[model samples]
Target: MSDYLIVGGGVIGMMMARELSTAGADVTLVDRRGCAEESSWAGGGIVSPLYPWRYKDPITALATWSQSSYVLLAQELLEETGYDPELRQKGMFMVSVEDADDARRWAAKHHRPLTTVDADFLYQKEPHLKENLGEALWMPEVASIRNPRLGRSLRQSLVGRDNVTVLEHQPLESLIIEGEQVKGIKTHKGEIRADKTIIAAGSWSGELVKPLGLNVPVEPVRGQMMIFKAPQGLVNRVVLMDGRYVIPRNDGRVLIGSTMEHTGFVKETTEDARASLYETAINIVPALADHPIEHHWAGLRPGSPEGVPFIGAVPGYENLYMNAGHFRNGLVLAPASTRLLADQLLGRTPIIDPAAYALSGRVTSG
Candidate 1:
């Protein structure tokens, strides 16, 4: 009896349910674990990739559009749900001796506001920074949010509405496909009959669709991050040292991240990863060496081979849709992806061409 059933209760699933329900669709969201218990919970809440110019145009455009909507989206949700999804716009600074040219080229390509500063200038901007530094690139729009809070607010906003329902700890066994059309979903309880279904199951999306003889080219990319509860003024803005970046929260805790490993579903935090994060954080701000490390965690990103998300309809199963494989940029693009998927599912025009994000297209290109 549900018009739409989202098969994951993370940011994507909950946001999509909110969008669809606002468009007057009956919606239910299900998650095997607690809501926002995956990448959405573990993410740094960064609104852009470390270097975004390396990706395709559509990906960049979609992310940009989504990033722009983040402020208003958070405001609206906060107003509706009485929850503050702390979206903070602290700037980003990248310091490096090598990869200078690559950083310059990428920053220019992305139209990021970049400023080249010297050792004295860098120290002046961040007094706690290590003086033994080279040139740095400053990007003003690279912002962050409290992702866990955002996910909770979104779920609350959707669930408070009449047309939305959220089912935590409920897992779908398989999709109910009949002659290339999805009529419902098969789960432990029973068959959930719905007019439309969207698979946004994050890393588990690939395994879930196997019984339906459908494959969405999404793989798990493990990212490990470390948190530092340091002095508030130790670092201003986000800092990118080496391939790793540092994000400072308003609560005097600096988030140091991340390690991109191909290890599948190994969620434990390793000593090497922690050390790597600590060394990088100290390199940016020498004073951070004195602070105690607060947290260390890892999450699985639903990555595609091409690094673009599977955002459109299935080849033979059009009624069954997909919105998975966002990988690291899921937090940045969540709003836009929700709108795009809603547009597609509700027969409205999408913000971008569906062909670019089509699951069938990615499979064929691969």
Candidate 2:
């Protein structure tokens, strides 16, 4: 029996396991697929929330905490696992934005560095962009990591840990419940017992805990993305307009994404999404139209109500916990979410207030 058993081996599960195992607890992490092959791999890896000023305080708190930790974490992972997650500090530019005053106020309140630039400034920064876009919001502190590389680093790091046991392709059949407490999980191979169990199964998290009469409210929100092989310096930074974005990798590959379709577990890529994304990418930078689309894919974001994740002990169970329902902010929020969960499990001081993320009596409405 392990001290902790994590059901999903995505980034959340791996990070949780890392946190616990580092604190001298034995951990066993299992996944239906291999680690980091799901939404963790499919994300664009933007470190900040899209339009940071628009979200409520709960999200801002988590993002703020995680952003401060990412730089150190990335360096540690690279040194330990010999895999670089390509964490880059390329700033993001939101062009032709509305609610400029709200953005300013939010930045000032949070003490994050933000600036407003006119069209000339925007053109000077991003020469390939469409001209005459007016004032845009620039966040120079924002960073982005390559999602696939980050996944690889996490998997490698977990495998190298002596106290961590990874079980791949082991699907969780059911939760072992005994008198209102979850003892462990029953996988296809056999029953694995643990002192504590966590359901970090991403979009499939709600289904895993439904038999326990707990409504986690995590659904699969499908997001489709495509990549173009462009020149390395074609697009200088992360560019966003409306809900879509264009992220430029250092190796001359530009990523364009995504559409938030509320499709249930349908991970298939659609022509409509591809066409829409392509149109948006070309409109942002006309030079991108000349490059052929190298790849197009989709991932299921674990859509939580109000974009807030449940990250504490389950309400009705003694030994069960949850860390799911992050929606589109999973990659950006993983570090803080895992730390909060670990802090609670280890009986240490939590980095932030835990009341906002409780599973019981959660305010799902805005």
Candidate 3:
């Protein structure tokens, strides 16, 4: 039997597998697709919370802790896999449409740096910005990573380890519960028994734990993003205006996103969505209108009601654990999530109180 059977091979799943293997556990990761191809690949890969002050203290705290932890995780992944999950501190520029003061107040309450800048200054910094904007707030510590590369690197780094295995295109069917613990999972091919099992299946975590009567409420929130090969000096920091945002990359590819639509398992890219995103991109950074559309894609984020992730064991099941439900934050959260789950599995002091994030209970308010 494998020491641990991880149901998903996304960022959290792969990271947990890496951690388990490093701790001397034989781990096997099974996924319907390759690692990171799920929401992990499709995300904008920003490391900061959307609006930290909008959520509870624990949510912000966990997000903050996770953000700091990823700095080192990126370096380690680069060394181990030779694929860099390009994490850079470009900071974020949040422009106010009409609520500049409200955004600033929220930023202050959350303890995030809020640099108050005028419209002309904003125009000078990013000349392409729409002149109709009101004010701007800057958060310097906010960072981002190349998300697809992170998933690729995780797969590369873990595939060579003797203690771990990654099986792709093998969609999980059901769980095998034998009394007190999970025996294994029944995949399309055959049964693979595991000493212990953890369901880290992004949005699908809910369905996997259902046989054991464990409930992990989750759904997919799809976001469409468009990438453009920027002409010259254009937008730099991540810009959040109205309901839209812009993310820049190391390569000339500046990503303009996104539209939050709740379409169950519909991963198809749409032209209407692309047109909307392209229009929004030009609105945010007018120069983007000049650049040809390099690429456009859509990604599904495993959103929870509370906007916080579920990262602990099932309430009744002793051996079956869960480490999923990290919606838009998965890319920023890979390292911290892995470390905490490792500590929990290895029987060590946890980085935070695991009860808060336990897979059981009504944490929808979390």
lDDT of 1 by residue, 30-78 (tens): 8888889999999898887776656777778778888889889989989
Instruction: For residues 1-366, write the lDDT of model 3, one tens digit per residue.
Output: 898999999989998999899889999999988888878888888887676556666576677778887788889989988899888787877876466676678767767676777788777767778778866777788888888998898899999899998899899888887787788888889998898888888888877766665556778888888889885457667888777888888876788878888998788899899889988888878877788898888888888867778887777668888887777777666677777888998999988776667765653221
Per-residue CA lDDT of model 2 for 1-366, tens digit only, reads: 999999999899999999999999999999999999999999999999999988879999999999989999999999999999998897999987778899999999989889998888888889999766888999998999998999999999999989999999999999998998899999889999999999999999988888876666889999999999998899868999987899989797999999989889999999999899999999998899999999999999999878999999888788999999999899899999999999999999999998898987862221
Tell me each candidate's TM-score. 0.93, 0.98, 0.92
* lDDT measured at residue 61 in model 3 versus the true structure, 0 to 100: 63
Error of 3 at 288 (Å): 1.0
Off by over 4 Å in 3: 97-111, 363-366
What lDDT would each prediction earn against the true structure? 0.81, 0.91, 0.80
Regions more than 4 Å wrong, model 2: 363-366
Cα RMSDs, all models? 2.1, 1.9, 2.6
1 or 3: which has the higher lDDT? Answer: 1
**Global local distance difference test of model 1:** 0.81
Comparing candidate 1 with candidate 2, which one achieves the higher lDDT? 2
lDDT of model number 2: 0.91
Model 3, TM vs. native: 0.92
